[model samples]
Target chain A: MPRWVRHRYASLVVLAVVIALLPLLFPSSYYYRVAALVWVSALAAIGLNILMGKAGQVSLGHAGFFGIGAYAVAIGPTHLGVPPLASLLIGAVLSAALAYLVGRPILRLKGHYLAIATLGLGVLVALVITTEIRWTGGPDGMPVKKLVVFGWRASGADTWYWITAGMLLIGTWLALNLDDTPTGRAFRALHDSEIAARVAGVHVDRFKLQAFVIAAVYASLAGSALALMNGFVNPDQAGFLHSVEMVTMVVLGGLGSVIGSIVGAAVLIMLPQALTVFQEYEHLLLGFLIIVSMIFMRDGIVPMLAKLPGRRA
Target chain B: MSKQSHFKTLFAAAAIALPASMMSFAGTASAQQTVKIGSVLSVTGPASFLGEPEDKTLRMYVDKINAAGGVAGKKLELVIYDDGGDANKARTFATRLVEDDKVVAMVGGSTTGTTMAMIPVFEEAQVPFISLAGAIEVVDPVRKYVFKTPHTDKMACEKIFENLKQRKFTKIAMISGTDGFGASMRAQCVKVAPTYDVQIVAEETYGPRDSDMTAQLTKIKAVPGIQAVVNPGFGQGPAIVTRNYAQLGMSSTPLYQSHGVASKSFIELAGPAAEGVRLPAAALLVGDKLPDNDPQKKVVLDYKKTFEATANQPVSTFGGHAYDGLNILVEAMQRANGADPKKVRDEIEKTKGFVGTGGIVNMSPTDHLGLDLSAFRMLEVKGGDWALLPPGT
Candidate 1:
């Protein structure tokens, strides 16, 4: 068996085992809800990792795609009479198309200029969602219709837990497999050096756009999952702060590592919950904790641990 | 050597460590004799101004209730989660409150967004939830388990219009913020204006963060016979608008603000420009000034004194909303003789003439928020302080 295939099978098995076993320790359904959130957030971070980690491109506007998916599920069922599942698919397609259109021009810019352009895109999406109060419910947001799969109604934390966990596994598997793909190799080549990749005839721009499009689909799917699970959608889902959060998760989880992205999502999502015990000092303590973690493991938790002397790659 | 083994070990360790750490903090087992009350508030983020006071108020009141020999003869146990103004986090905390803590009653949603997010969780769990948010949508359709203490934006508009009617002023211009609270209040005012014999001849909007509303005010000033200019916004925007209105020398036309700026900070922020500015607010702001004959006088004064003494800060109407929410829930729990969620919900629904910091609440089957226009007190900023206006004008 190929080494990459074995690696993919191993990661999937471990993730599946963790998902299957975590419930044994969950004292109540609330943990399931929280875990579901971690999974959904991780899925988005993994999508972002493809752009940031694999392609060495930064996107601060990923949440705009997330908002599209969330609103699609919300507006589709309520106004368009489309099924929630179908709306999720439609959102992904829409996000991919938008990413392609927008990435063509903005992705050409590098570093801070590209960052600023993406930031503007995110702010614009948030403004539209907030101003279109008639459809989007303004800043107060609107309730999403319950996702119904055939005869089964997707409600409850436990149901969403299984669904989101399954989705995360698939997302991780796809990301892991992409590591060895021709497009994935091209992304890595461009990430190493754009000029070098161009000299090697890697079609740098096309690969960057492809990574952006794939990342958008991932974010859109994650957003739909979250909206469905929460039974609500709001403009904050697409806000600039959320985009910053996605980038933070990717960077903190070990940039290009699939497992690292998931780990980063888990830490960021769960740390706040854990730190709620600090009462009014919650934010202060959270900041302190993040600073401490970064000081100890600068390359992110998973990557730093995996690089331990005894662990052979 | 396969890299898979190393990855597998790391994954297993992480997965176990994360849940294990969370489980350690899963709340220690308590005796069943305690009545659990859960709350999810935006205590640490942008809306912390509302939630901080609310959190302080709940902790103070719960301690007071427990010291007063507890509600329904069972100790009151409070479980609170600060959602940091994130609606998604608020929803998760709501689930934890309902499922993990198994709270019979819940209070606290400092903002409209947080309240709206948690409404479904409480409704699905059949837990009695009294919100402190200022949105009308919270109790409009009357969800069985949902109630609110704060006056809705619609009531604010109505009270202002009623004041306008008393003054016999029909022509008005509106400069509203384009944010959620401002936009919704503006819409409510527009919807209810004709019924009050008021016409909004000129209308303009300012962004939430805009420092100067001079341009909008200028446009409103251009309109002929603009009797009064109403600014329906909260935060620093209203204060800036007040300053801009003063700077523009539009004092001849009376200025009105919504209940969103019913805090001492608004008066402080607007400074001398706030003079003669009128807005609808709760009785809590004018607790010391209320006549002896008023029904809410004693309740309002007592809450003010206790909250001020304990919190070490002047009381805010936002805190008063939490005060009202808790008292309503406790009173319902006392009447039901226990903390059974269904009984408490029904009792809360049947609450009548319960004097609170906000006003005299009279809930019913159809009306979740039973306070009428009478509950709102029209106050004018006089000499850099709130001065209660008489019922008519």
Candidate 2:
């Protein structure tokens, strides 16, 4: 606990500062642009980590929540008379509430079953968005309203970077803080052994539902951020491939760690772009990398690296 | 450790802060050179078949224009991001292009779904953009900035029905993808059915990724009065539609597909089933078949030869849209005589007679999408090639 104490808010503050300054360092605006993308994708992965890493549950359809968050933010304000900020909060509440109701039933399922159920949920959301052209703008998607705060519009990338960075720091702090809380202990206990945690008097189902709701809220917020930043929302955010990408980012970085989710999101988002040719070779490289990671670095890159040289395991 | 003491120490001491160190080199660059235009295409995702070639065509046109003393005496710096069929990614890149890179204008988004997500960003920034996708919704609820180059599903459907009207194929069955393209095409078909007196005996949809269309085909075949089948714009939907038609022994029943099937690639993919398959297209692909004086003849031949030589891949309608889109954008830039986005957009709207590989694009203030029914030329596959359908059947 003392060891973790040194890196808590300080590390988050540093991360926040870095996000704010990253655009300045870029040779061109393109790098800052990709960096901002890293923040959005990282936000999404962090949401999923609550379910996969902390909650002792799995979800493949979290993107559905993300998409809902995005669409609601864009459409809610433009046509529904809700302001952009209000729509963003509404999206989070709706996604979290829906996650609570759905998680109560499906959280009982294990492994692949849980994943597939979530997958089905995401597909259903995407299908509805694409099919309901009148309300949701169909597959073509709805135009997003500009996100205005206090009667003033966000000036440019430099200004918005601060807002996103602030949210990311807050999100990270909350997740890390929760890890040290009693509910967090119960969730971790459930992750280690469900039966053992049950015998130890942990309310397994409630904890799972709580984590699911929390993660769904994170995803919804991430979606809102994307919609607000870009001023657009489309059904493709809810598509199955998007769901897969979130998982891939988590798994690629270091699934069980909060830092891993951020790192994973950063790496996963930047890598494919760095390896643009990797598009044709993505399935092959991704498969090989996953297999190798699972076989060798079972605990993921962060933990595995933590175990190496001068570090305590 | 005291919380305040720990925070002070941690904030004071930098422990291998790569992100912060990376951020230390921030510098703003101001330049006066060429106008930059950015685009996001689904170049590597499920829709790569559409995105990849479109990206290629865009690069080709930019190169061609820049080589020819550039547009408005200023070369175009074309920037692109491959969304790989992901909407969120498209949104991200659109913002980057418009905000960070400070592109004067934006053009060439792929898939109606992806392009739809970008409309708000373009509208918010007041960046003029031209989407190459065929969805009517891209232009619908029309944001002043979002424009399109390809004909909408409604126009394509009407043109197809008109061609069928001439062919005297009245009773038809419909096969479609469960995705947006399929749904849009189906809506157009239903709306136009009454005008053509065409009775659609049955309508079937297959999952977007479904490898087989046996069930849908079997149902379509069972329709007693079905004389032909109309397949909407599908990536692999035509192969399934044609294969299942052949399997059901309804090969004699004339099959018409959306312009999506007009490319030579479809013929190769569908094999013998592609023969006699008709679709409306702007490109007169079979050069020898068209008269020498045809406007598109020279453009088509040059592109076909250039693309085959460079990419070693057969051409597609996706490429045609890319060609038309870039040519128009460049023309607009030339007409604007500067990199001003609003000026470029207005000039684009006022464009009258510009020849593209596909057709003559004539943009007007009221219609950002200029190609009407007359712009479409009906083509059918014969011996694994696009054969222009003779006028009046």
Candidate 3:
């Protein structure tokens, strides 16, 4: 068996085991809701990791796609009377198309310039969502219709846990598999040096655009899952801070590790919940903890831990 | 090869450790004798100004209640989670409040967004939740288990328009912030304006973060026969608008701010420009100024005194909303004689003549928020302080 394929299957099995087993320790259904959030966030981070980690691209406005996905489900079900599940797909497709249209020009920029451009894109999306009160419900947000399939309602936290966890597994599997594919190699080549990849006959622009599109789909799917699970969608879901949060998860988890992305999501999501015991000092402690973790794990928690002695690749 | 196995171990250890820690905190054995009331407030984010006082008020009152021999023979245990003004987190915390804390009743949701996000969770859980938000949609469509303490923006608009009608100011201009509160109140005002014999002659909006709104004010000033200018916004935006109105010498056309800026800090921020500015606010803002014959005077004064002394800060209407919500829930619990959610919900629906910090609340089966326009007092800024305006003025 090829090493990459073996590693991919092994990672999937481990993740599946974790997802299946975590519920055993949950004292109540509340953890399921939180776990579902982590899964959705991790899926988005994994997508961002592909762009930031593998392709050496940074997107500060990825939440724009997320918002698009979220609002699509919200508007589609409320306005167009489409099924919630169908709207999720429609959102993904719309996000992919929008990414493609925007990525061609925006991907030409590099570094801070690209970051600023992407930031502007995210702000514009949030602005539209906030201003278009007729459809988007403005800043106060709109309720999402519960997901129903064949008369079965997908409404509780436990059900959403399984749904989001299942999606995250598929997302991680696809991302890990793509890591060693020809297209994935082209992305990595471009990451190493865009000039070198171009001289080596790699389709740099095409690969960059592909990565962007795929990442947008991931964010869109994640956003749809979140909105459906929460049963509400607001403009904040597509705001700049959310975009920064997706990037933070990617960077804090480890730039190139799939498991790292999941861990990062878990840490960021769970830490705030756990820190609620601090009451008014919650944000202060959260900021302090993040700074402490970053200092110890400069390369991110997963990579830093994996590089410790006695670990074998 | 070994790296994968190591990661699996790490993942397992981390997952187990995290939840185990959470369980240790949440799994205390005192669940039987205590009436658990859960809250999810935006206690540490953009809406913290609303949530911080709310958090303080709830804790102070819960402690006081427990000290005074508890409610229905059960000690009150408050379980609060701060959502940082994020809707997603609010939903998650609402689930935790229901399933984990097993709270029979809840009394927090600082912002409209957080309150809306949490509604489905509490509804599904069948727990009675008293929200502290100001959006009209919360109670307009009336869900079974949901109630709110704050006056709706629609009511605020109606009260302001009622005042405007008395002043015979039919032609008005609106300069509102584009934020949630401002936009919502503006829409509500526009919808109900004609009923009050008021017409919005000119409309302008400023972004939430804009330091200056002179442009919008200038446009509003340009409108012909504008009898009054209404600003439906909170925070520094309204203050800037107030200062800008004064700067542009548009004070000849009376400036009416919304309940969104009914606090004393607004007067401090806008300085002398806030003079003669009128808004509809809860009785809590003018506790000292309320008439002795008023039913809300005693309740409002007590809440203001206790909250300010304990929190060591000036009381805000936002905090008063929390006070009203918790007291209303406790009153219902007392009448029902227990903390059973169904019984408490029914009792809350039947609440009558219960004076709170906001006003005299009389909830009913059809009206979740039973306070009418009379609950809001028209107040004007006089000498950098809130001065109650008499009814029909």
The numbered model that scores best in DockQ is 1
lDDT of 3 by residue, A58-97 (tens): 9999999999999988999999999888999999999999
For the candidates in turn, chain A alone yields TM-scores of 0.96, 0.91, 0.96
For residues A58-173, could you state the per-residue lDDT of candidate 1 as single tens digits? 99998999999999999999989999999999999999999999999999999999999988888888899998888889889999999998879999999999999999989988
Return whichever of 2 and 3 wins on lDDT.
3
Per-candidate DockQ values are 0.47, 0.35, 0.47
Clashing pairs in 1: none
Point out the higher-scoring one by lDDT: 1 or 3.
1
Cα-based lDDT at residue B162, candidate 1: 90
Q: Candidate 3 on B112-134: residue-level lDDT in tens?
A: 99999999988888999999999
Interface RMSD (one decimal) of model 1: 3.1
Candidates 2 and 3, the one with greater DockQ: 3
C-alpha positional error of residue B351 in candidate 2 after TM-score superposition, expressed in Å: 1.6
Rank the models by TM-score, top first: 1, 3, 2
Candidate 2 wrong stretches, greater than 4 Å: A1-8, A15-37, A74-90, A147-162, A271-298, A301-313, B1-35, B66-68, B72-76, B124-127, B140-145, B167-171, B195-201
* Window of ten residues with lowest summed lDDT in model 2 chain B: B8-17
Worst 10 residues of 3 chain A by lDDT: A1-10
What's the TM for model 1? 0.97
Clashes in model 3: which pairs?
A: A313-B1
lDDT of 2 at A311: 37
